[model samples]
Target: MNMQRSMLAVLLASTIAMPAISAEQGGINAEQGITTAIPMPVANNAEADAQLSAEELAKQQAAEQAQKQLEAIIGASGLEGLGEQARNLAQQVLNETQAPLGFQYDVVDRLTPLWAPVALQNTLASALASLDDQQRELLQSTLNSRRLQNARSKELSAIADQDNRNYQDYISRLRQQPPAPARVALIKQLDEAMQFSALLSVTRSSVYPQLQAVLRNWQPPQDWQAGLQRDVTEFLLYVHRTTPNDELQRLAQAYREPVLQQWLAGVKKSLSRQAG
Candidate 1:
């Protein structure tokens, strides 16, 4: 019976091995067929290579044509004329689209009221003084838009040189004073003004250095370390926001006392924690 069982196991092993051997032989035959069949692809590959070459040549020709056209346009019309033509084409395309009602008309009407005559005359003179009739007409057409005229007027009206100088002088006087509550209040008022560019100029010219000096001489009160930390952090952030990064680094280096450094480190750690 043991010999019979051993024979049965051998029979089972042979059954599995026979299939594996047959599969291996079949795979080898399949591989040989694939290798023989691959040569058939060479014709297709040559056809594809020829097609790709034709496509590349077509693209190259198209690009050359486009470049030549651009050069011809530049030579004949000039860059400014080309730009004006492009703009007019774009506007025509935009006008044909049914996107919204009255939007373009509203924009044009809004701009017409603001046009400055003197500035427009000056601009036209500057643009057309050296040009021929055709070029002058082109420039006039470009600048003749009601919107352009209005924009020039608005720009001229917005700044009075005398008033601007006076305001800067006032700000300088305020900055020279001690950093009392009044000065801080004045700074806040200036900051709230709509003319932020002018305000910024005055702040950089006047207020910033004064604030820095105040910070340098500041003596923190007892039990005021926390408040000092907060103030310094706020001040640094203010500086960072108002001053450029290079200027901020210089200011930071100037204020790198032990207390200020400690405050800055705390601020950095707090920021990192918030970010995380």
Candidate 2:
């Protein structure tokens, strides 16, 4: 009985091994009289290799494009000279000087009332010019106090700050995420909001009267009561009209970066959301 059981186990093992052995050694189909091996699927590593190659090539191309753009920007900025010290100094000076001009331009653009009446323009100019330094300070302080007291200034400030914060947050978030089609749509929405906030920030600066004073080169006239509104108005207008767009363009190029773009987009989106 033990011998019979051993024989049965052997038979079972042999039955399982038969198909595997035949697959390796091939066989003849007796009825068809044909011999064939068991077919196995071939792995097409070539396709994977090609895909990897394509991705590598794309990355290389993108790197080259970014390098070229950086070179072009540097060349245009007049920083092509090889003198390291000179380049550093030049960059430093530009950074210091250009920032204020850009900010001023932005503020002037957003807040300055459109179309100052010829008569009122003159009155404003003359009033600014006729004040003593002490009187000017007092008047400025009073105006500032009044603006702070007004709901408009506080509301605008709150809105601008919130938009700026939103813009910054979105940009930070995007930097970590993988690129996708949805990002493009989101970016566009953000860009518009950024522009709106920029404009709003300028408007909220409340620099219109101060700008007029500076343009007027205000001085206490021989006749204290007299106003030189027209002259002051003309200067303010001239400053507004003649403020070059070139500086803003250059600054835009200088500050261009993916993060900045994202931030800009975010600001824009925030403003749009508020508006809607």
Candidate 3:
């Protein structure tokens, strides 16, 4: 009975050990399969990432190259100089007897000194001159208008300078005045004009309309009547010099006082006559 019990115990131990060994073998097979599959997926992902990075880098380099080329062109040939050349070309065209042909050849010859690469200069001249008769006329008209406008601007600048000196003199006198309300108002007006003039000289035409809007709705500081007259005078002078007739008329209409409105109308008429 004792021998049979010992043998049964040994049999149970072998059965348990067999299952443990089988489980170990199964685990080793699973680990090997995972290790082999992992590298292929990882390598594919790395290759895809590298390709995408290369494409993005290429796009960035292309954009930078385009920007550099544009800068080079603009630096070598300035817009203002080109505009002057166009103006000169238009004048030459006007003086030529031949309707179009002589003017075209003359422009090409004149611009050769200004633009490098004689071929490019000639090409541009021919392209510009190839416009239809109506387009040519329109270009001529615009050029003529610009020339006249530049002349008028010089004249207006001289007038404005003289007026500014007079305004400064007025301010000096007002400072010596006996504390009058009108004198105070005039000082304020002069200050506003000075500020507006600086803006007009530097800012673009598109922004000038917005300035007029603000000026139209502006109100004088309260209890400062004596210091505001100069300010009003300066503001009006600036508007007369810079603002168009249509805008000035609109401003005149917006003012409640009939006298101020009439004054603004007179200013518009004066500007028109001067421009003409």
Candidate 4:
């Protein structure tokens, strides 16, 4: 039984640790791709409680959150009460899924600074290589414009500042208000929501749509645009495939629950506008 559990952990870890390629600006790094190993058994020594950097602590918390979400989905049929066997199964799955991720993190940490720049350069070059010479030159010229770059930077900063202010206000309100079931549920759903938001951003910023608008005059091959869309969709599907189908269905249902809908109303409207 112990050996079986160990094998399961290795399989899950390896499956989730492989990074799926994404075309958009933000792609998953090692940290976001998976998570830490099965936590070492807590020790009584002070060394066991060594301080972690804020970023490391945040990643640890995120891993914990993912564990809770996965457990919730797996135990959905009997979530109100878990028997010992169910609890054990959940732990076994969690350990297996995250163990390989720990090794991946170490490798990525060592190599990222050395290879990330080259990888990014290659990705950009590959994208540009698909365009006709005139089209590629046109984009290169626009990107080189200092005024346009500055304008975009200022615009993005303003948007980020407003978002920060809004978030702070939300947090302040939560502190002042009494606890409610809906509020608690919303808090629990945050990590999943953020993942969804990331997916939305990737789809929204996809090169296929940009090319559709920019290359309207160029009349790029019909098959070329379709291929780009297919590639982007496949990448997104790969990320989603990490979760079991039943778990994904449960997550979708939970998002539609009243508590999440209330919080997500504004986001839904914004997404709809983008779609339109």
Candidate 5:
């Protein structure tokens, strides 16, 4: 199946029977956002009959907190109310600006209150569900700080108000200047810390089984999963391309904080485990 179709299937599996939630998506955005959850994969133990293991309790609590946080972020974003308007606004922004190539502008337009699928939301939950309270707190605080940093970057960069030609010209010049190797390395670090790739991977893996269960004779392209991965990667690169370099740097720096690095390592590991 094509990636968009695959995305649609994930959303279908998530919300088909569930009540339509208010357009609360995940993440915080200073024109950006983040989200997480996980609960199911805790290994069973010898103490199963006695009481909840500490790990089990922590994971359960983390999942509950993740669900609550997800709700809060979604409500704050008011993404549901802006459904069609987001598309219009994104297009309008691109029309006014010297739009970046690919899907970057669309990403900037929609990053806030990200209108992601329910399955994707669940994938995030599953990712964070393994953390303890301390880790979860770190996630909220770190993401909130990143949100502020993004807002600050937008304010300081003033790219929003710059003349279109000059803005595009600046990007052209910046493109000519090869980025510092460290900066490139840092950007790659942010990419891993962000968890978008892992979420996409795990969500796709989770969705395929649902598709098989839902549809009879669900023959698909042999390389369908790879196609889905390629599409998602390219699309996210497009999003990354539109992001201001300075802002991207800030995101990288924010996530490089030790606490987040430690927490996200576990989350990424969990999601990857599911994907495999």
Candidate 6:
């Protein structure tokens, strides 16, 4: 797939925030996958680890904390229980439905700087992590409760997934058929809750310099940023297509809690610094 077509896939089954559960919940968490499954594993550089500059170390710590924050949000969001009920049902839903998105990992691996997603993921996590314990619990409870309330909605999360295939074929048509102004407003709120543009900008900033460091001959396409932004907006729109307006409003507002915004700003500052 071409890069633009695959921009939607960077979401990696997490249109919300890719919020993996943190270690406090358990050792077996998705955070492990982020560090391990990255296209270029930074964990492999043992020798380089020791020599990190203070600035690099700070960024690393910020990234780690952000990751923990993300995991915290994801883990708490699960229904409280030791049994399968506690096993992040939302994550399961995403994993199952992501297949239709054309998960273009190859494209993500090739063009974007290796650290970009790592940074982005952690930035999102940090924003999520910023919420206080009570707020976090509220966020978790709200999601599960709303979802259960509308259990009547057939595959509520899966509706958008079905319409996600034929990436190229759908983009033009999708753009032409713009969402209603109300939907657009909600989407903008959703982006704010998630710190979508801020984190996106943060990653976009480092991409070129980092790429130059590793791939001297590499040059990014001019339209790459615009394309990715469009995909992100559309992907989120698709996910929420079947969600009830009231529930969707609450969901977006949950993340916009003052605490999340505060954390979002902190991570943005930290991630703005280069890892190297």
What's the lDDT for all of these models? 0.32, 0.32, 0.35, 0.35, 0.45, 0.49
Which candidate comes out best when scored by lDDT?
6
As for candidate 6, its clashing pairs are 20-71, 21-71, 22-71
Name the runs in model 5 displaced over 4 angstroms.
Answer: 1-134, 146-189, 214-216, 242-246, 258-276
Ranking by lDDT: 6, 5, 4, 3, 2, 1
In model 4, the number of clashes is 1
TM-score of 4: 0.23
lDDT of 6: 0.49
Q: Put down candidate 5 lDDT per residue, 171-227, tens digits, no spaces.
A: 455457745666555455555655444544544454344333433355335885566
* Per-residue accuracy of model 6 over 1-276 as CA lDDT, tens digit each: 112212323332233345444333212233557455766566655445555454466666665775554465544432111111111221232244453233334323433332334334554455554576677556545544554335313223433344556544455666888878888778777767766665665555554454444344555567967776776677566556667778778767766667545655766676565333
Evaluate residue 128 in candidate 6 and report its C-alpha lDDT on the 0 to 100 scale: 55
- Superposition error at 73 for model 6 (Å): 3.2
Quick one: best TM-score, which candidate? 6
**Prediction 4 global C-alpha lDDT:** 0.35
Off by over 4 Å in 6: 1-71, 74-170, 274-276
lDDT by residue (112-174, candidate 2, tens digit) is: 232112221222223233344454444334333432224224333433443366534543554
Which stretches of model 1 miss by more than 4 angstroms?
1-38, 80-276
Error of 3 at 193 (Å): 36
Q: Is candidate 4 or candidate 6 better by TM-score?
A: 6
RMSD of 6: 17.3
Q: Model 4: per-residue lDDT, tens digit, 1-276?
A: 011223322322322121222322322242433565555456632343453344456666665654443333222211111112122232343344453554434433332321233332223233333344455334434433453344334333433443366534643554466345543444334324323333333323332233334223433345743444433233223233234445444544544444233323433343334334
Instruction: Judge candidate 5 against the unseen true structure and give its global Cα lDDT, from 0 to 1.
Output: 0.45
TM for every model, in the order presented, reads 0.17, 0.19, 0.20, 0.23, 0.40, 0.46
**Model 4 clash pairs?**
9-96
Q: Rank the candidate models, highest TM-score first.
A: 6, 5, 4, 3, 2, 1
